[model samples]
Target: MSHVTPALYATLAEIVPELHVHCVEPWCVIGSAAALLAGADVSVADVDLLVSRADADTLMTLWAERRESVYEPAGAERFRSHFARFRFPGLPVEVMGGLELDQGDGWKPVKARRLTLAGLNGLAVPVPSLDDQIRILESFGREKDVQRAKALRALASSPLRGED
Candidate 1:
């Protein structure tokens, strides 16, 4: 699945009452899918979610219905939903709920956040902080991936373009 629907958003909201999760790469680029469709070769594989660790179980339950048989590359337990859509190539949107890809430190959301993307039907979601993303990506040097992480860093630094 590539694009997450309102139902999925509602389901996700059921889990994380306070959805302060930030939208990161792949997904961040979703608003710009038209650019890719217009001759840009970008990979829209998965949604790198950074949600509160506390809501992990809640989210798991919502997506449990479509759970597919897939293993995590890091050897952690993997969960999947067959219904999510993919607006990009090869990458089916994924939920990066916690820090350790599934078994690490995930933040406890302080508040609920309304999703800004269109078609979400005004639902809230969860995710992690920008600094964490930079730290994790910076630890190892995967040039391309790290570069992508930089975008998160930028967004974090400037919460609102007009605010600064």
Candidate 2:
């Protein structure tokens, strides 16, 4: 299972409901997780979530016990957000609130232009559309991100684009 495994889907199904109940603002899965959800051939190490700052605070407070205090997020200079990591059964989950990206210009908010619901088992996991995900990856401007964007672009042009 190079992409999402049964264990990972189970972990997400167990956790996402709690987030829906607690988070007041809209939130969606992002990064490689979203790419995987969109049927891209990508490996996902952890789940990345995009949420409102208030929602992030709420989740952080709610899951304080699960917080990984020692783990520091990378790309501090290129990205800024109220970020926190939580431990789950199958994988680690990272939440970024009010995320922004600075590509040498000024800081600008990073958000999904369109969200697509990915059906995983019984859960309707929200993720950015393939095009939006590609745009976001390109905006990051990292070599790895650019590569991921290329993967997503291929998916977008493939027949499986609307399957998600």
Candidate 3:
């Protein structure tokens, strides 16, 4: 488990202000990033963002100037079904409006919504609740997702250091 470093957060603050960023990546500032932000030892390879269809279009147009390559699909047809992938500097970014998680019997749609703020190093980064994250991961049912859900569950049950 690796945590997000101050430098990474700083970079995020510069590239995507908290106001414009909505973290939907489990391994990003919301999942691994939140864990790291909470003092857990965790690290991930890239960033995932959940933005509105409009925002996604805006990002596609705006980031084109800084993108290293053309947008590509993330992975399996199901996974890549709704996502647009690209790279920025040292970060891999995925923008999507919705996601479908495999539930063994069928796929469950995870709809996008207005993101709430999660405090990290004084920055209010948009993120989903721990329960929401766990639900999404559990639905995926992959070994790694199960492991991540467990970690997130543990984090959720623990007390926030400064919260009463």
The best candidate in terms of TM-score: 2
Task: Output the worst ten-in-a-row residue range by lDDT, candidate 1.
Answer: 29-38
Q: Name the better of 1 and 2 by lDDT.
A: 2
Query: On residues 16-127, what C-alpha lDDT tens digit does candidate 2 reach at each position?
Result: 8987798887789988888888878877788899999999999899989999999999899999999999998888999999999998888999999889888776788889
lDDT of 3 at 138: 69
> For residues 16-74, could you state the per-residue lDDT of candidate 3 as single tens digits?
66325533342223445544444444565556665555566666676766554655654
Range of the 10 consecutive residues with the lowest summed lDDT in candidate 3: 22-31
Q: What tens digits encode model 1's per-residue C-alpha lDDT throughout 1-164?
A: 23443444334344333333422222222211211221223343344343434444444555556444463433234222212222223233344443332223442222212223322334423222334334544543446546646655565556463321
Which scores higher on TM-score, 1 or 2?
2
Greater TM-score among 2 and 3 belongs to 2
The candidate scoring highest on lDDT is: 2
Compared with the true structure, model 3 gives a TM-score of 0.70
Clashing pairs in 2: none
- After superposition on all C-alphas, the RMSD of every candidate to the true structure, in Å, is 9.9, 1.8, 4.7
